[model samples]
Every structure is written in C-alpha cells, then in structure tokens.
Target chain A: MKPTPTPDFDKNHPDRAAANLATHAHALFAIASEHIDSDTLRRLRAARSDALSAPRRRNLLPVLVPAGALAAAVLALAVVWHPLHAPSTAPATAGTGAMLVSADSSEVDMAQNLDFYDWLATQPQPASAASAQ
Target chain B: MNLAAVPQHSEGLVAARAPELPVTLETFLAQVQRRAFRVAEMGLGNVDDALDAVQDAMLRLHQHYRQHPAQEWSPLFWGILRRRITDLQRRRKVRSIVVGWLGSVGDDGEGGPVWEPADPLADPAREIAGRAAYADLARAVRALPRRQREAFMLRVLEGLDVADTARAMGCSDGSVKTHLSRAMEALRHKLEDWK
Candidate 1:
C-alpha cells in the first residue's frame, strides 16, 4: 500500500519550518555554547566591557564639545558687548576711544596720527577754496 | 583658560545622559553575545574566528549605532554582525582557495580536507544520544552553504521575524524566505534521524 503524503506544514509559513529547524538545531547549539567555556566567556565579557567603555568615553567628547562651544560663545558675547555698553560708569581714563584703541590695534594708529590730523585741520583750505570758487 | 577653570561642560547633563546610555547597550551586547558567538561559530567553524566576528560586530554596533533607540538595536546589531560574518567568510573562502591552489600543486595526500571539521561524534564517551545528535546537527549546519547558514541562523535560531531577518541579512523578503526554506529542507534531510 502507498503511504500518505505529509501535509505542507511549512507552506505559506516560512518561520514555521525555520522554527522546526531551530527546534532541532537548538540542542547542538546548546552544546556549542558549552564549548564556549569559561575562559572564552570571560574574554567575551571583557570584550563587551571594552566595547562598552569605548563609546562612553567617546560620548564624553560630544557632550563636552557643544557645552564648551556654548560657554565660549556666551563669554565672547559678554566681553564684546561689555565695553560697548560699559554701564555708563566706566572710569573716565578708560574712555570709549581708548577702549576702541584697545579693542582694535588699527585704532591705535589712528589715535597716534591725531596730532597730524589736527595740523592738517589747521592747514586744509586749498581744496575747499577751489570748490567754493 | 577660564573655560577650563569653571569647566564649561554641564556635569549634570553628562551625568544624566551618560548613565542611561551604556547601560542599555551593555545589556543588549551581553544578552546577545553568546548566541551571536554561536551563530558565528556555526558560520566560520572555528572558535577564534567566531569570537573575532562577534567582537568586531559588538564594537561596530557600539561605535556606530549605540544612539539608535533600544527597539532598533536588534536589527541594527544583527545587520552589522551579518556583514562582518559575511566579510570574514569571503576572506576565508579566498584564503582557502589560495591554499587549495598551493596544495594542488604538490598534489600529495599530505593535507587533509580544508572545509570539513573533525568529527567530534566519533568518540561517543557514553554521552547522551541527544548530545551526539546535537554534534551531528552542528556539523550539518556548519556544512551548509553560507547563505543557507545565515538564513537559518537569523530566521530560525535568532527567531527574527521575516522582515527583521531580511533587514539583517540585506536581502529581500522573498529571498529570505527562499534561503530559509532551502536551509530547513537541507537541515531536515541531513538531520533526519535527530527526531
């Protein structure tokens, strides 16, 4: 007599067949786990710890970096705007011109040429006279 | 300098963000490490290679994708492991091919088979039938082709859903199904007496 054909238990269901195979495969996998003995397991754990620690250390940089940038930006804004607004109570010796000269070295050259500018102011009627005529 | 003096970084924020971060990652890696190593062993057929693959995968996942949501960790880590295992498998294949070529030159019976592992089942040692059968199963699974092994491990052993397995293996759902079916059929045939 002919035997009956087995039903398609795994048909239309991939994981079913996979599950069956896994069921069969699990025992050997367990044995294989045993083969991954203590020393190996320890190393694997150490590897995990090593791997874990690296990212945490790396993560510190990102946190520190953005915060550091924010602080630097805030400090810079304060330094720049501090003398600009000056609370109207800054020392008279620390005049805005002197502050500008300190803030920009180019202003030192302008300040140093102030005497020349004053002499020129007393002597510069040539161009204005020609234009007036 | 004063930036260093006050320490501009938010110590509180760092403490808040960091404490929770690696805990989940470490848990995930710890949970999966053994099984991942097992799967790699199945693929590579050697403990060292398998552990290397596992460690590389772990490092890659931690270094690259730790910030992904916890739920996404499974697929991402598996995906990385899949790639690492595949890469190592390819490199092994190339090395074996070169070795085979060199061996073929002498054409002597000196070197044994390069692919097949030693039969641990040969020595029974009064072990249980289940253990012996498991040895056979591991050998059989290792004997399977690379794609079939990957499909089997991911879809079956790892219990990833088809979509997740597909994502992990970098293949289409249909391809995953096909490979998994072929793997199951092959394993069933090879391990017919296990039941």
Candidate 2:
C-alpha cells in the first residue's frame, strides 16, 4: 500500500520548528562548550599577548637597511650643504675675493665664511668687455 | 654650547610628554581567540591549519592594531583571519596541483585516518536518533554556500547580534538575514527526519 506523503509541517507550524531549532542549537552549544580545551585557551592568551607586545618591538628588518641608507645620505647632504648655504657671519667682509679661495678646505673653518663664497659665486657675472683668447 | 643645552630641554620635553600607549592586543586576543580558532577550523576543516591561520591572523592584528581603531578591532581581526583562511585555501589548492603534477609522494602511513569525533551525546535510543538527525543537520550546514556558512557561524555559533555579525562579515544586516534564512531552509530540509 502507498504510504500517505508526510505533510509539510514547516508551512503550518513555523514557530514550533523555530522553537525546536533554538533548543537543538542551545544543546549543541552546551556540548561544544564542554569540549573547549584549557591548553587551547592558554595558547590563545599567549597569542593575544604576543600580538599586543609584538608591535612595540616591531623591527621591519626588510625595509630598515634601505631606509637607513637613504636617511644617512640625506643627513650627509644636509650637513655638507648647511654651512655652504647659510648667511655669512659678518656683512663687512661679504664682498672680499678671498672667500672662494678658502672654500676648498675639507676641514670646517668656523672663522672662514663658505656662505660668502657661495653668495659671491651666485651673483650675476659682469658683462666682459673683451672676448677670452 | 647651546647645542648641549638643547639635548637637556628635549629630554625634559620627552619626559613631560605622555607615556607610550598600552596596546590592547592581549586583551582582544583573549576575547576572540577561541572563536577565531573555531571559525577558522570550520572554514578550513583542519585543526592544525586552522591554528596556523589563527596565529597568523593574530600576528597580523598585532602588527596593525596600533593604527587600527580600538572599537573596530574585533571586526578588523575577523576580516584579517578570514583573509588568512582564504590564503591557506589557495595555498592548499596550489599544493594539490603540485602533488598531482608530481604523481604524488607516499604517505607516512604513521598516523591513522581522520579520526571521527564521536558525539558525546550519542547514546540511548532517543539520543541515537537525535545523533542521526543532528548528523544530517551538520551535513546541511557544511553544504551551505561560503557566505551562508560564515553568516550562520557568526550569528549562531559566535552568538553575535545582527549588527555585529554584519560588521564582521563586511555586509549589511539584510545580507546576514538572507544568508541565515537560506542556511536555515537548507538545514530544515535536511533535518525533517528529526520530526
């Protein structure tokens, strides 16, 4: 004999289905919670602490060398250019022709003015009356 | 020299400034680690790989948490973890391709087959019937589309509310509801035997 096909209970009783589902879900959750391992919990605690502390000690070694080199190059250029570009120490000695002669010394001459030489060199040259041979 | 005097002033200024900020990575990890592990495990279907994904996600979170907002940390962490799991899936696919190309290596044959975890609640006639029903339910859940699976896990397993689940999943609450509804329908069909 052909068995009567089961009615679609979900159509007639949605609330009943939902309540059962919720109950089953709650039971599943309770079971799953019991299986939570203490070791896993400890490991999780460690991972979190590591995550927080790791940034404080973060050393991006991959980028450090290139960044350091670039910074050093910039700093060296600044050091070299600073004295040469600064305003001269005294205005009275500004136009003296001896400034350029002393500018070649590698040793820093605190008393001598490299800026005066730089200023002097930057000035527009006089229109030469005679052509150079 | 004034230059020598400048160092002291700078040092004093630094001391007077606020202390280094205490990042809450540890605290956040304590809250999310287990759920993250479970989510990863469900997504990848491998405990060791899931653990690795969780660790990698935690490390990445640590790396970025300083710049990330305090309130958005949970969502941001979950997003990073999801990405890590995706990466792991891609890597597994590549490994499979490589293995297939290489004609495969011999298994170590040491460890036993994938151990079936016996449901502790699987006993007695009523419980046995429940177990079979639950098995069908689990299979239905496992068969869900990726987004639906994620939505269900976030909303149901993690017990996150709709707004929070939406934030974590990077979707609207409506999307969460849609995914959840589809998941529920699929499970309901599979779980009809439970009636």
Candidate 3:
C-alpha cells in the first residue's frame, strides 16, 4: 500500500511563498543527504554492518547490577527480620520463675514430677492449709 | 512432476515473491542511515557527533526492535535517532559549560558534510548557488527551536506523515502541526531574500 502523503504547505493557499520555500528546501536537503563525503559514508557503512552483526540484546549490566543489588538487600532484610520478629515456639511453663526453658526440658520435668504429684494428692492436706487455700 | 522440477518451481516462486515480502532489518537500516545522518548533522551541527549519534541509534534499534514488524521500523528507527540526537545535544551543552568553567577551548566547530556535484561537468555557477542556498537553509533550520526543527525536518525533508512524525517526535499530532507551522513561518522570513 502507498504510504500517506506528507502534509505540505498548500500551493494555492495564501502562503504560496512558504510552500515554494518548503519545496526548495526539500530539494536542497535531498541533495545534501546524498552528497556525503566518502569517509563519512565508509563510517556509516561500517556502523551499519556492526549494528547488524552485533547481538540483539543490549548490555544490561548497568541496570542489572543495581537491580541485583537491590534484590539481595531485600533478601538480607527478610532473613534478619524473620529471626527478630518470628513468634517464639518454646513452651511456657509456670513455676519456672524467670529462667527460660526449652520445650523438651519442660516436658521432661513434667514427666518426672508426675509420680510425686500423684502420691501427694493421695495424702490429705492439713486443716489450716485447706482453710487458707 | 519430477523432484528437480518441483524444487525449481518453488525456487522460482520464492524469487518472484521476494519483493512483496517485508523489508529486512539490514535493508531498512541501509535505507535510512544516510538521511538519518543528515538529520543528526543538522541537529548537532558537528559531523563526528552526528555520525556517532546515527551509529548509536542504529545499534539501539537493532538491539531492541529488530524483531518488530517491518512497517514499524520507520517510526521506531526515526524515534530512536531523534532521541539520540537530543541526548548528544544535551551532552555537548554540558561539556561546553564544563570546558568554559575550566578555561579550556571547546570544539564547537561545524564540520559539515562535504558536498560534491553528481555530474563532473555540471555548471559551476549553479552548483555554487545551490550550495549557498543549502547552507543558508541549514543555518536557519539549526537556529529553530529543537521541536520546530525536528518537526520541519521529519515532516518536510524526510516526507514522513503527521502520524509518523508525531511518533518520531514522541508528541501529539496537533503539536507536530503547530511546530511545523511555526517552522515554516520562521523559515520563510529567514529566507525571504532567496529567489
């Protein structure tokens, strides 16, 4: 298909002088574009060949470097934050006072005291202690 | 049909249909390189910088949009070139300022393209007159605001339509018209004495 015609200053319009000037200037530009020096032409040819032969993917190192660094920084922050803010899983044990105990140790202690608690339950409490309780 | 005959017939068909196919990247680049250079030269007013800009634009188009449809190449290529020219212009301005502050002489000379007559026996008087006229036109164009110059060159010299010129300029079609109108008015006044 033919391309759309470029809009030009109308010859029959009031600005005939401008139309004429555009026409003249276009012709001159055509000439100038064609009459490039041999050296410049050679350079242009080399440039074209280089462009065509070169890889399609641009060197994204500049962009990728910063992007990669940002991603790494975010990952580091996440790693640090998870440990600092994650909920504690250790079992809460009453009567342990201010001492912190691991879940396994707390469970073991409860098992060892089971027999003693059972024996104590079988014995009756003193009257004064019962009244205080 | 014999196998040889089949192959030959298909080859003939392919050859016949070649012209109807979309333009390849190399062909597109070859077609626009010169005119692109000229436009760059006009914008930057330096030969080496213009050539660099054209080369950079060609590389960018090849790298980024080589796989696009052929019909999209013109606008894409011109748009890339226009941006490259603007970039070079900005760099030159910054360099000039820095050089001035350092008390160093900057190379702001216009190393324009060398023009030669196509016909060796062409009339010297006519050739000289044409050259003078072209020089004047180039000067006037360079003096225009960046947008106006871009609009004038793309729309007038390169013969790109309003839509393509708008795409190339990264602006609205209405803005292209306004800039072109102002450019023409300015050029007419500037070249009033030219016959």
TM-scores for all predictions: 0.58, 0.53, 0.65
Docking class of 2: incorrect
How far off is residue A80 in model 2, in Å?
27
Q: What value of lDDT does candidate 3 attain over all alpha carbons?
A: 0.72
Q: How much is the TM-score of the A chain of model 1? A: 0.32
- lDDT, candidate 1, B87-179, per-residue tens: 987887887787777777765758654764434334322333345555566678778887878877776666666787888888898788778
Superposed model 3: Cα runs more than 4 Å off: A1-7, A58-88, A91-133, B1-22, B104-129
In candidate 2, what are the lDDT values of residues B84-147, reduced to their tens digit? 8778878877766765545445365443323333342232113222334333444566567878
Give per-residue lDDT, candidate 2, residue A60: 79
Candidate No. with top TM-score: 3
**Model 2: lDDT of residue B163:** 77
Error in Å for residue B129 of model 1: 7.4
- Considering summed lDDT, which 10 consecutive residues are worst modelled in model 3 chain A? A1-10
DockQ metric for all predictions: 0.11, 0.07, 0.18
Interface RMSD of predicted model 1: 16.8
Full candidate order by DockQ, most accurate first: 3, 1, 2
Backbone clashes counted, model 3: 0
Question: Could you tell me the lDDT of residue A63 within candidate 3?
Answer: 98
